[model samples]
Target: MEDFKELTKAEEQIMKELWEMERGFVKEIIDRLPKPKPAYNTVSTIVRILETKGFVTHESFGKSHQYSPKISKEEYKKGLTGKLLTNYFDNSPKSMLSYFLEENRLDVRELDEILSIIERNK
Candidate 1:
């Protein structure tokens, strides 16, 4: 989770592509993007930053470098969630759960399952 660090919006977008592809060269990433793709150098620079941040790694395929994620998407999200809980929710999972239950309408079945889990845990 510490490996996730944090990514800028641009970096997140690039990471999303890498996560989707599982692995890709710079050209593959650039090609799969939307109609108005970023410049090659721009993507290259960002990927380098991601590598430096420990979010990505590369393997040289002769002239080109193929990039892949160092952290899985799930692990990244877990790191982000842990930070969010500590920063915004006062490090209280109970408080966060209460906030979620209050803010959203939970279906009866879902509520029952959640209650059951709580009861079991207790």
Candidate 2:
């Protein structure tokens, strides 16, 4: 597995935007943000931090830079899941499933779907 550091809230927010847009300039990212959005420099700095963290890359177009995600959303999700499972679930899928089943309300349909997946995998 590739080594990775957990991203800060600000960095994750910017990554979500980059994942959705695929690629964008700093100003474009700021424009896509909701009302009471962060300043351009704030987003710009986060993007640079992401680049340093190996989550993003950029292409320089004269004075402006267009940034893109180096990792896919699914890959990031999988990484987080692995960390969660190892750190909290004793690296046991059964323990993780039991925790969810006990702590959350799972509809019959959802249970059936999970059972179907288990059956198919088996």
Candidate 3:
């Protein structure tokens, strides 16, 4: 598997659109964005940056390019989670889970559901 470089906020936004559409032109991506929308050139530039970073690829249709994500959302999320676990939790899953439980004030049912998931995974 290729190591994914972290995306800038703008790049991530563009990526989300590509992931949703599977593939699209710049106008299609911009149309899906929330208001206030970014400029067309701004999105175009970010998509190009994502291509350079190996996260996106484009198909050419005459003068137009349709972009798609090379990396899946789950893959990106896993990489980001690993980085967060290492940097903020000292690579300790226990510490991370403890922090989440303490900070979020999750109900007993939520905790039970989490435990069930852990048990199933194990």
Candidate 4:
């Protein structure tokens, strides 16, 4: 995959809704948002921006357009993860794992689970 492009927070929010819906109209997307909901055109413009970024596409239903993600969430994630590995870890899984371990975020059970995964993969 080509290096993934970063999305602004707004674009990412809309994309998350689309990913969950599989496909939806602009209003449908806006409906899924929390109480201080955005204006219809505000969401519509962002969807168009996403389309220009090659992250989305739409089909016409008369005057209305039903939007959909052109890329799967998993594919986008893989690209971003690869970028992170290359930029910060020299593309080394061991280096990435080491950094996470040093963060002290994992509990003993999580560490044991990771070790089990390594053993199974080996």
Candidate 3 per-residue lDDT, tens place, 5-122, comes to 8888888888888899999999999999999999999999899989988899999999999999999999999999898888899999899888888998777799899899999999
Give candidate 4's TM-score.
0.90
Candidate 2 stretches greater than 4 Å from native: none
Instruction: Give model 1's TM-score versus the native structure.
Output: 0.80
lDDT score, candidate 3, position 75: 92
Candidate 4, residues 1-122: lDDT per residue as tens digits? 35478779999999999999999999999999987999999999999999999999999999999999999999888888898898899999899888888998667899899999989999
RMSD of each: 2.9, 1.6, 2.0, 1.6
**Runs in model 1 with CA error above 4 Å?**
1-4, 105-122
Q: Highest lDDT: which candidate? A: 4
lDDT of 3 at 76: 94
Of 1 and 4, the candidate ranking higher by TM-score: 4
Show the colliding residue pairs in model 1.
Answer: none
* Native-to-model Cα distance after best TM-score fit, residue 7 in candidate 4, in Å: 1.6
Alpha-carbon lDDT, every model: 0.90, 0.90, 0.89, 0.92
Q: What TM-score would every model get versus the actual structure?
A: 0.80, 0.91, 0.91, 0.90
Task: Name the regions of candidate 3 deviating beyond 4 angstroms.
Answer: 1-4
